[model samples]
Target: MDSSGWFMWALLSAVFAAMTAIFAKLGLEGVDSDFATLVRTAVILIMLAAIVLVLGKWRNPLQLGGRTWFFLVLSALATGASWLCYFRALQLGEASKVAPVDKLSLLLVAVFAFVFLGERPGAWSWFGIALVGAGVFILGLKR
Candidate 1:
């Protein structure tokens, strides 16, 4: 894919993430957050499985490299934890507030990439990350 294609995909991801927050907030009514998370995970698993099968993209998991498997497992664990916390937050807080706080991960990702991935974001990129941090901070202030 073209290097520029990432922007479009990232934009779509943001759109879907916004939808997820709204939908999850509504779905949490009269439901346990953890259970709701499980249901959502199951749905995602089924949907992705179908997509993979339809696209003939299924590969033997056992054939993957140990490092790949390890990191994928770690990533999956982190995602699961994030979903659990997000669902609970949605259960107890306003979606508008919770979503922005959740997006604090964007700033965290930049910092982590710089430290662990040896990714030196340019000055403009750092400026953008700072803006995101400030936005999240401003949104977090109590009325």
Candidate 2:
């Protein structure tokens, strides 16, 4: 895959993420959100582990550098927190509404990248990010 391949991969990720919201909303019925998150995490762990093993990508965590391990651990923690909140939100609200609010993260990511990663989005990129923020707010409005 080349640099241009990323868009297709990202598009597929969006598709799967959409499915995830719908499926999780239905699955949350009669289940505690925290418990549901644990189950979902376990399933993800198993599935990713299988994929890694099948692809010969199983790696020894101990062999990774400290910086890599630290960032990976932090990212995992953040993902866990996000999943917990997302599941709880889905449990309490309509999936359509919850998912759009959840996408406010897209706006946050742009800001975070600029501040922490020294990323500078071009004018149009910032415009797109602003549009995403506006869309989230519009979708989340009580109507």
* Per-prediction backbone clash count: 0, 0
lDDT of each residue in 32-61, candidate 1, tens digit only: 999999999999999999999999999999
TM-score of 1: 0.96
Task: Give the alpha carbon lDDT tens digit for every residue of 1-143 in model 2.
Answer: 57879989998999999999999999999999999999999999999999999999988888999999999999999999999999999999999899989989999999999999999999999999999999998997778
| Model 2 Cα shift for residue 73 (angstroms) | 0.7
Could you say which candidate leads in lDDT?
1
Models 1 onward score TM values of: 0.96, 0.95
Per-model C-alpha RMSD: 1.4, 1.5
Top model by TM-score, which number? Answer: 1
Error of 2 at 76 (Å): 0.6
